[model samples]
Target chain A: MSGKVTNGAGEGTGGSAEGLDAAFFARWMRAAADAVDREADRLTELDSAIGDADHGGNMRRGFEAVRSELDEGVPATPGSVLMTAGRKLVSTVGGASGPLYGTLLRRTGKTLGDAEVVTGEELAGALSAGIDAVAQLGGATAGDKTMLDALRPAADALADSGGKDLRAARTAAEKGAEETTPLQARKGRASYLGERSIGHQDPGAASAALLMAALAEAGGDAEGSA
Target chain B: MADTSEGARVGIVLVSHSKQVADAVSSMAAALAGVPDAPVTGAGGLPDGGLGTSEEVITEAARRVDAGAGVALLADLGSAVLTVKTLLAEGDELPDPSRLLDAPLVEGAIGAVVTAAGGGDLAAVAAAAEEAYSYRKV
Candidate 1:
């Protein structure tokens, strides 16, 4: 994992899109689960300050469940693997974030339908759907101190940027995530924290960035194969 | 995904510390179900017992689950787990969903309902819910 963050549309340092299938997506999810597991305690610690301390633990459990479900024998299509994983998240997580994040994946997977191979543009649409769903549920806008702050911009940049490349999208997501530090939270438990929420970063937002970053790495591998 | 679409029914019983949590989870589950009339119901332990009165909380939660497809009980604390376990062995009002075990709530409930709605069986949904327990923040 590159601890260094990148910015703007030109930051396509990672690989581009290749054919993405079920196995590739499963691997992406696996990496994401691993990242979440590794940092679950950190996320929970962050949340412990402003939100429920369980956010990290909840996400870690949900993603781990997804990993188990996939390892047990996933479906044939890329979309199905994601759809199944999304469904699994919904069942295991028991907080506001669970449904919100789970819906993101489930909705995105649904957009892909049963496609065996997903294009860069299609993946963008799926991610957009996930972001939109989260926005609708949380009622949080782009500037709000919530995960949407990171997600909305990332989706927009990914959609409008140079060539719809995976690396470009990931860079956009990381930059968007960093931009959250200076703002006061207007939604979620952070919102209740008011002025105190300004200095601390939102854990959900951080994990959201992690998801995009890991996807970028995994997609790079796929690009190499293609 | 196991098929539970056919006469097979698996109910969702939301167990939160407050009615607000239960309502919110049920609402989310209904939305995920995508069917206007789909009944993804919930039960709350408002003024949550936490560690005390586990049996009472579990009984209520189990009753709610029993109302639907042979209830799947989900709770917030360890005692809630103990309470539900006792209810399974002693309560006679309805079929128990307690065996699904203690889960995260939001993700677990949603995953169970979504998978169940997508034709996965009660066993599969329960297993998915159990798997969801691992989705914890860490």
Candidate 2:
């Protein structure tokens, strides 16, 4: 889906779009943490139905750790910030989410390289890479009723929009997450429940949607400030 | 029996969802193998003693058990296996000659520890662990 940049080229002198700075990325992480915190109880409730009841707590704790690490000192580049956060999550968070989410951000950040800023198109491509890594690590697909349920659609929307319309990507993720309510989970702990896993929204997918919403909000805020 | 040399022996790592389970299994395996100082490490549960596996814990355990010989990892559950595999892929320390065995946790740990303590190389230890899967008690 990350073929080429199409619209909203930003205000760059060259043909490339304006690069999103490290501050924006940091805000994105902060927003995501806040979203996870807000939805932690609900996430846990959902997980308790078909899987382990630690999704909410795990995500909240991991994001809080990331926030604290960022507070200590924000990195110079967006990629570095994400890389550090990913590493922190990998080390601190337990369960499948730790490695899955950690791989996502680490792979995405690695794709961003050491650049101080990256264009929206570049960010979109990096996000796709990150989602792919998560899928590969977890051995999950779009219909697995895992985080990929939201992430795959969001990544596709972002890439289709050339990373210019964060709101559109957020909407896609929301829809994808909602759609997972009726699917029988095919991966992760929920798979053990068999047919009982159906009719309940996947906690990981729900959280992934929340993350996308936070990213959209951060993107809009950045635009407003600029 | 192999050479029983310090550097030639393989190391074993036991991964489980519960720290207590991992510790017990490691102890049982060591006892069964009759090797007091076998290079066996237990990586289970979260840092907070919760019921889950941690990549950091596994990486640390593997590092501690690796005594110039290679390391073999055996996990009890799906997530545990995934965590260990992820750590092996991403860890910076480079756990060379390390292998993740798809064997039953208790039996595999026992077989692996015995082989490793006997100074079996990486392949031999891994084979011993895998071989445990085929044993029939009946």
Candidate 3:
């Protein structure tokens, strides 16, 4: 469906595309929805340890809304797609993650403007802005043992990779999620647990890694002849 | 009591993770309010009445209660606050003067409604709601 595949001279958005268009973004979202669905149980298990046992159900419901919204018809610009999905998630999820994730995508899409296609750096910059908004809304930073723990490092890796290497971002997100196991949470429900919060990976961070992984998987699929 | 400000009366809003709880709080506030036409409302839970916050319900409740003097919003628990903050960040949906007050649920709702019903301004209503935390029960 995507004829934007490059002819050997890669511009680093991936091996096959000079810049990512709306279709690529749609695929990315679909992949993300799939990952959320696949890992929902694990996320819920993590949440039950230190927080409420609804993280998995909340994420699953949120992404399912996004996926169905896309199924109806993806929006014209990549930004609109994300913006639409963000609104849907916010409206349906009914949890803290709903607003947090909604703000991340909605703010990022807003930053992207109405551009049909955007470079990896542009996406990186927009994503960084989104992450910043999440931090402000949550009032927590990199070491807070929240989604920011995974998302902050993931965004940094994407920026450091010049935004072209979703793989690097994926690795950073997964590693960051894993590293949260030893940290006591300073924000969100887990914070109430205090010392007990340690030894449990944050559910939000785990889901964030799933998101990054889906992005990388989509990038890989786009570069291939599928 | 005569409303010192010329704008519409201040409104009170309560947000909880459960719809029943929010509505009950609103009822309690209304029953003890200082005015006949109390501009107070409560909203919570998802569309299915599940345990979680709803941005749509919050926005709708805020708008419904707003009387131009603005609204003082209070939420229960973590996600409820986060959801309210997200709506505030959007900067458009809710009434411009509406604010998310940092206060306890039942106490804040009752305090905010009483203040607003007595014709308090937006700032006064918010302060009264927030000050609900001061009266500690030992």
Interface RMSD of each: 11.3, 1.4, 0.9
Query: For residues B1-138, what per-residue lDDT tens digits would candidate 1 score against the true structure?
Result: 544334545666666556667668888977987866443565554234221222333345456444344667665543233334333533463364345444687878777777666656567778877888576585
Better of 1 and 2 by TM-score: 2
Q: Compared to the true structure, candidate 3 yields what TM-score?
A: 0.91
Point out the higher-scoring one by lDDT: 2 or 3: 3
Q: Which residue ranges in model 1 land beyond 4 Å of their true spot?
A: A1-18, A161-164, A221-226, B1-15, B18-138
Ranking by lDDT: 3, 2, 1
DockQ value of candidate 1: 0.05
**Tens digits of lDDT, candidate 3, A141-198:** 8888999989988889888877777777788888999999999999999999999999
Q: How close is candidate 1 to the true structure, as a TM-score?
A: 0.61
Residue A60 deviation, candidate 2, in Å?
Answer: 0.6
> lDDT per prediction?
0.65, 0.82, 0.84
Worst 10 residues of 1 chain A by lDDT: A1-10
On the 0 to 100 scale, the lDDT of residue B101 in model 1 is 43
Q: In angstroms, give how far residue B110 of model 1 lies from its true place.
A: 26
TM-score of each: 0.61, 0.90, 0.91
Clashing pairs in 2: none
Pick the winner on lDDT between candidates 1 and 3. Answer: 3
Model 3 lDDT on a 0 to 1 scale: 0.84
Docking quality band of candidate 2, CAPRI definitions:
medium
